[model samples]
Target: MSQKNSEGKRSARERLQEQRRKEESRTKRKRTLIAAVVVVAVLGAGAGIAALVAGGGSDKKKTAGPLVAPQGATGKDTVTIPVGKPDAKSTLTVYEDFRCPGCGQFELGFRDTIRDLEAKGQLKTDYHLVTLIDGNLRGSGSLNAANAAACAQDAGKFAAYHDLLFKNQPQETDDAFGKKSRLIELSGQVPGLDTPAFRKCVEDGTHDSWVKKSHEAFSKSAYHATPTVLLNGKDVYGDQKNPLTPDKLRQMVTANAKG
Candidate 1:
C-alpha cells in the first residue's frame, strides 16, 4: 500500500506487456517468412512441370522415323505431289490437311474447276499435305489419310483418291481415316488403285514419314491454317475479306494461262 510498492507493481505490469508484444511480433515475422517460402516453392514446381511438358513434345518430334519420300514425290524434300501437267503455264500451290473441314470444303468446291483446268493444260497444281488437325485434336486421322493419299499418288490415282477422301471426310473429332482398312476400302473405288502395292503402302505407313516431313515444313512456314492456296506464289486463299471462289480461281488461271 506504500507509494514505492505501488510504483514497483506498475513497473512490473508494463514490462510484462512489452514482453508479450515482442513475442507476438516475432511470431508474425516467422509466419510471413514461411508463407514466402511456400510461394517460391510452388512457383518453382510449376516451372518444372512446364519444362517437362515442353521437353516431352520435343522428344516425340525427334523420334519421328527416317524420312521416306513417297514414290514420284517432287519439290523440296520430295513432299510435293504434282497433279497436273508439268508444262502447264499456271501453278497452284495447295497446303491441306485431310481432317480439316475447311480443306474438305475447298476441295469439294474446286475439284471440278481444278480438274478442268488440268485437262486443258492451263494449270498445274502442287499439293502439299499436312496433319494439323491430328496435332490439334490428338488423333492420327490426318496423318493416316495423308499417307494413303501419297500411296494413291504412287498408283497414279492421287487426284481421284484425293477427291474421294475429301468427299468422304468424317467429322473432325472422328478418327475414321486412321484405319488402314478404311483407306483401303475407299481405294477399291478407284480403278487399279487397290493393288497389293497400294495395300502394302497403306498398311505399312510407307509415306507417313514423308507426310510428317511435309507437316513440319508447313509448321515452320508463315501459314498457320489449312487450305492455304497460292497462285503463282501469291496468297489467293486465307484472306477472309477477299475469299477465293471456284469462279475466281478459274478466271485467275485463265488470265495467267499462256498460248
Candidate 2:
C-alpha cells in the first residue's frame, strides 16, 4: 500500500475513537442528571411526609371553639371548680391533670380526708384542671377527660365524677379517656349525671375551650408538674424536705380552723 493511504486509514480510526469518547461523556452526564433528579424527588417526598406527621401529631393544640365555663365555676377567668362551702375557714388549692398518675395517687390518698373536711364546712377546695399529659405524651385523653369532668360540674356532680375518674383512670400510655363513649359510660355511675344534656355536653366538648384556658393558665404559672397542692396560697405538696400526707393535711386544716 502507498504511505498516504496508510496515513488516511490511521486518521479515520483516530476520528472514530474520538467520537466514541464524546458519546461516553454525554451518556455519563445524562446518568448523573437523572440520579440527581431522583434524589431531589425522594427528598421532597420525605419533607412532605414530615410536615403531615407534624400537623397530625398536634391535635390537642388545635384551636378550640367558644369558651363555656361550667356551672358555679369561680376564680380568675372562671377557671376554678370550687368544692365545699364558700364560707369555709380554710382553702385548699389544687392544680392537676386528669391523666397524670401523680394526680391520681394524690386523689386516692387524700380524697376521703378532703371530702370529710369539706363536709364539715371547715375547708373550701379550689380545683384547677390542666392537660399537661396530653401535651407531653401526644394524646387527647387529658383534654377529653378534663372537658367531661367540667360537664359533670354543670350537673352538680363534680366531686363524685372527679373521684370516679381518678379511681377508674386507665394507664398513662392508654388514651381510653380520649373517647367520649368511655367518658359517658363512666358518667352512668353517677346518678342523675347520665342525662341527655350531660351526654351532649361530653360529646360536644362543651367546655373544651374553658379547659384549654385553664391549661394555658397552668402553663404560664411558675409550677411545671401536676398534683400541685397548696394550702391557702402556700405550696404544700412540693416541699421534699417536709412531704405532705393525708393526716398532716387534716391536722393543718384542723389547726387552721381552730386558729
Candidate 3:
C-alpha cells in the first residue's frame, strides 16, 4: 500500500475511535439525566404524601360551621359539655377532638374512672369539643361527631353517647362520623340515645356552629394538642409531658378532693 493510503486508513481509524467515545459520553449523560429525574419524582411524591398526612391538602380552614350555641352550653363559646354536677368540688376540663386517636386512647383509658368519680359527686367534667382534626384531616367527621354528641346531651344521654363514640372510633385517617346516619347508628349502642330528637339534631347539624366556636376557643387557648386534661383548672399532665395513667388519674383526683 502507498504511504498516503496507509496514512489515510490510520486517520479513518482514529476518527472512528473518537466517534465511539463521543457516543458513549452522550449515552452516559442521558442516563445521568434520567436517574436525576427519577430521584426528583420520588422525592416529590414523598413530599405530597407527607403533606396529606399532615393535613395540608387545602387552604380553607376546618370549622364546625355556623356558630349556634347549644341550649346547655357554658363557657366563652358555649362549647363546654358539662358532666357530673354543677356543684361538684373538682372540675375536670377536657379539650378534645373526636377524630383524634390520642383523644380516643385517653377516653378508653379513663372512662370507667371518670364515670366513677362523677357518680360519686367528687368530680365534674367539662368537655370542650374541638375540630382541629377535621381541619387537618380535611373532613366533616369531627364536626358531625361533635354535633351528635351535643345532641346526645340534649337527650340526657351525653355520658353514654360519649363513651359509645370513643368505643366506636374509627382509624385516624377515616372520616367515620362524617355521615349523620352513621352517627345515629352509633347512638344505638348507647341506650335511650337513638330517639327522634337526637336523630333530628344529628341530621340538622344543630351543634355544628357550637363545635366551630369550641374549636376557636381551643385555638386561642395555650393547648396545642388534643386530649388535654386539666384538673381543677390546672393541667393534669403538666408534671409529665405524657398521658396520665389510670393510677395517676385516680391519684390526681384524690388529691384534688383533699384540696
Candidate 4:
C-alpha cells in the first residue's frame, strides 16, 4: 500500500508538471503573436509617415502643375507651360480672381488685342486663376470655373474658351448658372475645339490640379492684384510696360525687335 500511494503521488506530480508546461507554451505563443503585430504596426506607421513627408515636399517644389522636366527655359531656369508653345521669348502672364470685378474689366479691355498677339505667336499667355467669391454666388462655383478653364487649355481651346467664360459670367444670385455645367456650354464657344473631347476632359477633372497649382504659384510669387501681367518673365505695369491698345502693343514689339 505504501508503494502504491508513493506511485500515485508521483503520477499526480507528473500531471501537474505537464499542465504547467502547456500553460507556459501557450503564454509564449501569445507573446510571440503580440510582438509580431506590434512590429508590423510600427513598420506600417513609419512607411506612412515617410510617404506623407515625401509627397508634401514634392508638392511644395511644384507649387503648381504636375511634375515637369525643365523645358524651353533660359539658362539656369525652368519654364512650365502645359498647353502653350514649348518655346516663347515673350510671355504674358495674368493673375486674376474669377469673381473679381476688376479682372472682368481687364479682360474686356485686353481680350481682343491679346487674341491677335496669340495668333501671331508674338506672345504666350499664362493665367493664374483665383476665386475671390463663390458661396455667395454659387457654392464653390468660381473655383470650378477656374479649374474648367485649365481643362479648356488641355483641350486646345484656352484663349477662346477663356473669353467665353468671362463673357458669360453670371451675377451673384439664385439665377446664376452653376460652374461645371456652364463650362460645358462654354466649351462650344471656344473656336476650333472638339467640344466633345473638352466636355469629357473637364468632366474627368483634368487640369483641375494644374489650375490650383497655378493659383498657388501666383500667391507665392511677386504678383499683386488681379490682371497682374508679365512680359518675357518680367512684370508688366503701367502704360509704359503694357500698352493700352493694339497699335501701342505693336509699336512696343517693333521697338523691341529693332533693339
| Candidate whose TM-score is highest | 2
Candidate 3, 1-259: lDDT as tens digits: 9999999999999999999999999999999999999999999999987776567323233333566676677876577889998887888999888889989988888899999989988889999998888788687788888989988888888889888889999999888787778899988888777889888888777777777778888898899799898988888754566757878777877787787
lDDT by residue for model 2 over 129-213, one digit each (tens)?
9998888886678988899999999999999999999999999998788778899999999999999999988878889999999
lDDT of each: 0.87, 0.91, 0.83, 0.60
Better of 1 and 2 by TM-score: 2
lDDT of 3: 0.83
Candidate 3's TM-score reads 0.72
Identify the runs in model 4 with alpha carbons over 4 angstroms from their true place: 1-88, 135-138, 172-177, 191-196, 238-246
- How far out, in Å, is residue 186 in model 4? 2.1
Q: What does candidate 1's lDDT look like per residue over 1-259, in tens digits?
A: 9999999999999999999999999999999999999999999999987775565321123233566787778898788999888999999999999999999988888899999999999999999999999778766788889989998988889999999999999999888887778889999999999999998887777777889889999889999898899999999988889999999999989988844
Clash totals for all candidate models: 0, 0, 1, 1
The alpha-carbon deviation from the true structure for residue 106 of candidate 2, after best TM-score superposition, in angstroms, is: 0.4
- Clash-forming residue pairs, model 4: 64-213
TM agreement with the true structure for every prediction = 0.76, 0.78, 0.72, 0.58
Candidates arranged by TM-score, highest first: 2, 1, 3, 4
The Cα RMSD of model 4 versus the native structure comes to 13.1
Is candidate 3 or 4 superior in lDDT?
3
